[model samples]
Target chain A: MLSEAEIETLTGVAGLMIPASEAHGVPGADDSAIMSEIIVSAERTEDAVRNALAAFAEVGDSSFQQSHPDEAAVLQTIVASCYYRDARVLVSLGRKPQPPFPEGHEMEEGDFSLLDPVRARGEIWRKVD
Target chain B: MKTDPIDVLIVGAGASGAAVAWSLADTKMRIVCMDQGGTPDPTQFPANFMDWEERRNGPDHISPNIRKAPSDYPINDDGSPIKVVNYNGVGGGTVLFAGHFPRLHPSDFKVKTLDGVADDWPIDYQTLEPFFAINDRMMGVSGLPGDTAYPADRNNQMPPVPLGKSGEALAKGFNKLGWHWWPSDVAIATQPYDGRAQCINLGACLWGCAQGAKGSTDVTYWPHAKRAGVELWEHCRVSQILVGDDGMAEGVLYFDKDGVEHKAEAHVVIMAANGVGTPRLLLTSTSKQFPDGLANSSGLVGRNLMFHPYSFTEGVFDYPVDGARGPLKSIWSHEFYETDLDRDFVRGYMFEAARGRPPVNAALAGYEWGTLPWGEGHHDAFRKLNDRIMAFCAICEDLPELHNRVTLDPDQTDANGIPVPKVDYTLSENSKKMLEHSAARATDILNAAGATEVHAGYPIVYAGWHLLGTAKMGLDPETSVVNDWGRSHDVKNLFIVDGSVFVTSGGLNPTSTIQANALYVADQMKRRLANLFD
Candidate 1:
């Protein structure tokens, strides 16, 4: 579990990673619901998450992004994993928020005449007995 | 304890095992198949959950060492550059395959005769042509079949999958270059057939098809084999093949899910444990008669490993190609599939166009490549690449080398305490040359496709999907492990019907040919049953 102070620190960092976009109508990773999901997801790799957070805290949030790229990437992965799955974010990307099935998307059948050139090339395989 | 002896016993209920069992079901003889993995549940497939992308990178990973399911055995692949990827279940690798199905060309079967390279297969493309057609119908292949790259008479059971914007973009590139591109033959149901639903463009074929549209052998052949009275025992891991004093196979000793040991006796024992697992089992089953291994008089049970050396280049377009909208594999090019004496390499490669990555994967990949940044500009960078990138993989033909082998691990064992397989492999100079050439050609195609940016990576470390040629087939018992009909040379009642019997690892995916070889071997078994023991 994260203390209130750590959560606040994480919120600031998340906002820096992905700020709220008014034009796209999508909340930033710092949104409470998304942060809650990220915190929950952190439990899967608790040690690594804690280590990354500690590293960021030690470096201080202001210079963390500049001084520590590898540590920031750890937090980036955690945030992205949860943030991309959020309904608003998915919709902003023009994707359905729900699972891919039992309602799948339709695809357009492309033009087969695009292969006229290939077809005109004739048989290219070797003749073997 | 020993069970009653059956007419035939098959170890591993995977692609080849399922097909062989189904093909031999008409014989009316008592048959049994043992598989280590449990049956899959469609409701629990990753695509059914909102976190499908996360699951694909996690529990549903293609590498068994990473997935670590109870049925999966760990492979010690640290010594090799390429890692082995597999699914240890009823459907085997088919369960997680992208279903880009293609048959070996006629020239592939006679490599030694034409290219003066690896030994030629005892059987040719013509011999497996009928069987390939049979498998196509059974698997419900979908494609537009006048591909000039292959011989005449190649047909598809259904119309081709939608090319979508990504495929069309790549096809235009190939057309501009005057190269050979075709709608790839994929083992996915475009329309309803064989009791499966049509593909709904879930774009999650590699994580196990949630719609039951991909032709995994569990759905394609296991159902028919079971209906024909072929008993399938799941969660049963075979430890070794037991041989009688008369130098014949006497079934296998295996462990059930409970870790309890049991013995299954049979007149004939068929090994379909794939190239790695099959050789691992053979090397582990050492005895007084054979000494080295069962049916290993040629000392070639676990030698001559081959994997299609893989490379790819991704092109990023300004507009949305919607590359993640449909099946993973859409179109392919055979322009460089055949060998040319003028080239530096002996055999050639095929160019397979792949769909873009899922959103999460796309973001992660961008970060890895240092394109999508961490802070201020992450979203913009991601938007520019997501669904706008198209990738073309070069599946190069790797020649069989005796030094590249799968041997018994000196230390590690699986959860069931069975000795695990250790792989020792190195990329040959020929393969390296081929990968370099293919990457350059792929860049040309991507450039022709009007891409704003292109990135290429060679010798993909995670692409050991096509495991083959560890125990090859040939006419001479002194050189090969199995005979022309997949029968063992040293052990009369033993047979291997998997990729282990492949003499050459053709550039294309091997599942179609693997299943065809299995059906052909089954037919041969039936034709010579009266004199099979001779």
Candidate 2:
């Protein structure tokens, strides 16, 4: 479990990675409720985020946001993984965040015209007799 | 009271194990199938239908090393570039496979005679062709039948799934390039077949299908085999094969869900465990009778391990390509299936048309690739990378190098106190060259299709799905582990009917061939039922 301060900073980092743009209708890390989800759902992300923060502090002698290491990479994966999958973020990007089962997505019937050109030049088999 | 031995014992009721059991079901022999993992709970599938992407990194990851749920066992793959990605359930790897069912080229069987690099299979494609049709009927393939890329008389069970916008774009590009592209032959059914549901195009085939549409053996063969009176012991991991003084396998020693060990005896023991599990089971079953491991006198039990080295490329189109709508891979280009004298590599790779993953995977990938820019341009970058990307992977053919292998680790043991399989593998020159060529070709196709940007995963993180060649088949016992019919040369009553017996790793998803070989081996066993040990 991360300290409350670390969670806030990590949330802030997530915002930076995917900040809000009102013009593009995209939700930033702060706008979404994915931070808690990241902490709870990501595999060992809490430890990795804290370790990254410590590594950053030890390197830069300044707080977190210093020289990011492997731990930082792990944190970024966790943050981005949970954040982008959030329903709010997906909706803002004109996509559905829901899993594509039960009520499946609207898949347009394939345009058979795309295969017209392909069908013209058919049977390109290698002759190895 | 000790129980009497059954007629046959099959281990790991995944694709191959199920195929072998069903193939011999008509013989009216008592067959017992054992699996280390049990039936997937219906409650767990909704987690896939609900929190699909979020659950992947947490527990649904295909790799046992990452998805260390109760059903998985640890694998020490530190020695390899690509770690093992498989499951332990009744369906085996098919539980998580994309169900792309491309068959091995006829040329694949004659590698030594045609290519002169790897050893040739003792049996040719024609010998396995009938079984391929048989397995296709059983698995219910979905594809156009007359694609000249394969044999003219290919037996497609149903029309292929409809290609989405991304697939059409990729197809147009392949057409423009004058390449041989066709709708892939997948195991998923389009309509109801043999008591299973139809394809709903949910797009998460890689993460176990929740609709029970995809032809994973759990839904396909397990039901049929059970009805035919095959006894399947789920969540029972076999630790050792008990071979008597006569050097014939008597039965297996397995660990149950409660970590209790039990012995099941049978007249014949067939190890249908996959490439890694099969060799690990053999190497761990060492005794005074066969000091080097049962049927390992050839020392080829765990050697010559081959995982198809992969190269992935994606095209970023200006408009949204609704890639999130079909079977994971539908349209594939096999133009360069055979060797070209001008090419640097001996064998070639296949180009499979795939879509960008759902939002979560894409977001992670975009961040990792530095494509999803931060702070100010984040929105545009994420939008551009999200629904508009069409991705594809080049699955290259890997030849068997004796040094590339799976060995037993002495220190790391599973919950059952059996040695874990340690993989020692590296890319060969031929595979590297093939990948380089494939990546360049993929980039060309993407560019040809009027893409605005192109991104590629050079190492591709292709974590060894089509595991093959660990316990290969051959005519000579000194050179291989199993014979032509998958019968262990050292122990006649012992058989291996899985991808482990593949002499060569073909440039396609391996389940179809693995299943077909299972049918062939089962047929051979049935014909020789009177003299099975001979």
Candidate 3:
């Protein structure tokens, strides 16, 4: 599960990239956080994944980071990898993911099409983890 | 290569586009309606509330919206000035739009005459009365007409969507305040009009009504037009409206579903690509004869773009009102629907109430009163407030201003390398004042209805839902893009028959008016078809 700090950081980046002020409130920064969780948690039940993140954060409020302490480093690593990958992809589509893979697992190249502008808007949440 | 000529080329397949096709079906003209996306099916819509978000965002979630079917509609979203949020399909926005069909008041037409700010529409309500009646019957509007703020002559039979629980609660407040309220005249069938079934209170029209109740163009007019021999080219993106040397529309250049560029010559062209898309096509069609953009000699092709300003007001009751227990919304109030100069506003607003849904309700409640939905002590609070929270949203009237306009994005383009529509809009002081007045009035009504916790929405300065008046029609050729009959001044055979042709920003949702206006103008075009060969 992703950490709160990672979620907030990813949300901030998504917000900076796609401002709610610009998109008429459709894919705002907060929506980016939701989108990011949806993609990584696609294999898991949405509620279980969200609840797991909440447990990791140690807070009931989804956005608060102060409560969640243990899940910080892992979430940050995942988000940082995703963000770096996205930046690389921006320069050239379908770029390989950056090193520092989760638990030293070999990372594989993935389709960014899954992150369609409207759907993968939440992918920014991957930036903080 | 020679291109086949079409008698009529309709550029969009949304509500207005589909309506015009149906209106002109009896004319026996070879009509070709082109949309940028594929056609949607209503049968695949998700009905369960729990699974709605999955259906709404996931690829498998079949949209109940009568829009272009999904193929490979590509949109470019980089750091671009143009922020385009639109769906191109057979039914366009009508597929996604929350169908709250309320007719424009007579005062909506003569805004300048009544309040002296925006320009007046060339055609008044009386002029469009017959077409409105015709449109209502065709769409099967369900409501008690006499209860509306500005009631019209009962010229057509109405559908039977009886007042739901949410409507009853909202009506109580309006009745207590002695304000004019009514059941919202929606396109949903109440008693199974035509072949569709009655609305079983699905409460998810935005996603798509699987009950076959909501009257989408695909269900109502598209089939009718098809039966009448209207040729519809789904997944055809109309890029330009070509004008001949004789100052008449010649044809349209568009790309097929597979990205193959093709030209379809037409005797007349009708651009119904909505307010944003319609204006962009006209502005982008710059040629040697009209360098400033086709039909833009008046320099008002994309100017005066107006979107209705919306403000949501919520109320929390003592017991569980079970707000999210019925069809989205069945009741509305037009009590403060007037251009009251005393309120220091140029236009009016309509108040509509709906049962606040879960996530949104929780987020809003938390945002307004700093209450958390999750935690040990929050379950009771959630049950107490969730069902108790009902909303009264004010759809504020925003008159069209020339400075508030839509232009082609100088920075970004879509998949076909066409610049997306860029909207440069800001709320006027008059609009602000009108929202304040509406909000204050809504608060008063909510309080009267015994709401314990009331939260009013913030002032909207940059809302974009009720789009209208990008290519307005007027009697003066110099001041307007199209004539009163919706024929373009620059290109005689080109017509702008959508919300873009609206002269004034009416104080109502522009869909019904757009549909009605298109029907009226297509009828006029039907009479002028003989001039094509001559």
Candidate 4:
């Protein structure tokens, strides 16, 4: 249900966080349509908090749906939110979180081995904010 | 009125039943396994972890096992004579187990012999050691080896799950405190062993492991048995165990999925319907010869039920520590595993560093922010959730007493109109004492690990996980329904092979011990069969 851009971004983040290769032989974030599938299958649906943020692509850009008519900005927002939120959940479930850092600092540049941010970002997104 | 006959009839297809069936696979005798739940294809398991998260909210959250939908999934505690939490399909309790498998210590076997309290297990751990090793390999357990608490001959292979932060932190703290701890031995396959893939750290174990990394009998033992020519009847509820004039099980009467009665006769019947279900079935099957209940001559068929007291306490850590991302249990501490003279409790407690998946955390955080019924109050609660790190549960041992019992409710019945087991239970003085001691120690460990707020409590009333001791095994026929070999003392061919025959519950989870015991009994059953035929 998410917009193409938001889906792309979320998948991009999932790719970075989960990575294509890990201990479990790569549970790819990009291939995970789990959120989208769940949203479509719901008996009744509501706009989740994260979907609201997905309306703006990169802050300055118009909503992904407006720029690309075929896109589902609201859905993308919800999916991204749902995905990230679960990422946060993965954190609480006992995985160590990645260290927080300021923007444009090369998200992957930290000492990831000791402090895996993918799991942390996933935990933060899991929050209701 | 008429009875059909076979060699071995097994009930319930969970870990216990599956292991028993697997053990009996090589035998030429006809084997029939039955369960009251539908067999779900592994492919249909949910991919979304959020649905799993909501599942922890109990019946209120989105889960297929919601009480309104399935009669079997209900946590029936309606002031009945027996209260229990049971899963109705293939794999039984193994379907919902967190895969935390640990062997009950040798001291656990001789609790009475060593501690001067409770009844001693007729068979010691040494007698069951070979079976334990066999089951461990069959289940593909992943865990570190060489604990002094365990026998030297026991296998010590560790599972592939790298230790998580909580495990590391707790291990470090325990080392500093000189406490015994180890990476938990889990049924989850660490690597791609036995055709099952390794765990992806989905952190959603209780809702059922979709990845199949967490070993349940459905994936491990049952399929192999089925391949070797064992017939399985899913959604078939066994109602009565029919006995012959010679005091041997002649056959079993059960209702199929369509509510039609079907009879399967067996020379030897193994009751693996778990601690509660096994006793419930026995109590329901009252015959003319055994008037009180089938195999209830001692009046111990449904008595002496024991559920280990479970408690939880959490520690708060600085910064956002993502603790909800892997199998529920990754590590365990048995620092206080044995009886302690310094404490008032008879048995020790096992501490586990476990994961609480996201949706559960969200529900715990008190609903969504600014959403009606959940305003800023809820938002603030959600904000602080990430800073929590927890040393999850400490299972304290509870002694088997005659007073703590399970009985069939005359008024209540399952979908098939059979009486459900009503649980009439209370924490004995020893259990309460053990719980208090474990809670105090749990709080101390949390404080020592720099936890800001430590919360501790006893097992929620009727929160049944490890059902045990309903049909206990003992050397004394007057006190137990089954003998040391799990064969019924009263009936010649009926065997009780689940947790129901346990005289005492160790601080550890019951899955490994149950599976081991089942294998041992199955081996005995094979020998008995050869002797009868030859």
Native-to-model Cα distance after best TM-score fit, residue B148 in candidate 3, in Å: 5.6
TM-score of every candidate relative to the true structure: 0.97, 0.95, 0.78, 0.78
| True-structure lDDT of candidate 3 | 0.65
By lDDT, rank the candidates, best first: 1, 2, 4, 3
Native-referenced Cα lDDT, model 2: 0.81
Tens digits of per-residue lDDT, candidate 4, A1-129, equal 555554555455334323333432323334466445434422123344234334434433322334433234333333333433444434633433321111101111112132222222222100111
Query: Which residue ranges in model 4 land beyond 4 Å of their true spot?
Result: A1-129, B1-5, B43-49, B58-83, B156-160, B357-381, B530-534
Query: Pick by lDDT: which candidate is best?
Result: 1
In terms of docking quality, model 1 is medium
Error of 2 at B313 (Å): 0.6
lDDT of 3 by residue, B254-344 (tens): 9876778888888778888888888889988988898888999899998988778777787878865544445566667665776555667
Please tell me how candidate 3 rates in CAPRI terms.
Answer: incorrect
If you assessed candidate 4 against the hidden native complex, which CAPRI class would it receive?
incorrect
CAPRI classification of candidate 2: medium
Residue pairs clashing, model 1: none
* Deviation of model 1 at B159, angstroms: 0.3
Candidate 1 lDDT tens digits, B1-534: 225569899988888999999999999988999999988888888999988887776788889998889999999999898999999989998998989999999999998998899898999998999999999988889998889989878899989999998899899999999999999999999999999999999989888899999999989998999999999999999998999898888989999999999888889999999999999999888889878988899988889999998998998889988656688899988889888989988889999988787788777778667788666677789899778888889999999999999999989999878899999999999999999999999999999999998889989988899889988999999999999999999999999999999999989999999999999999999999899989
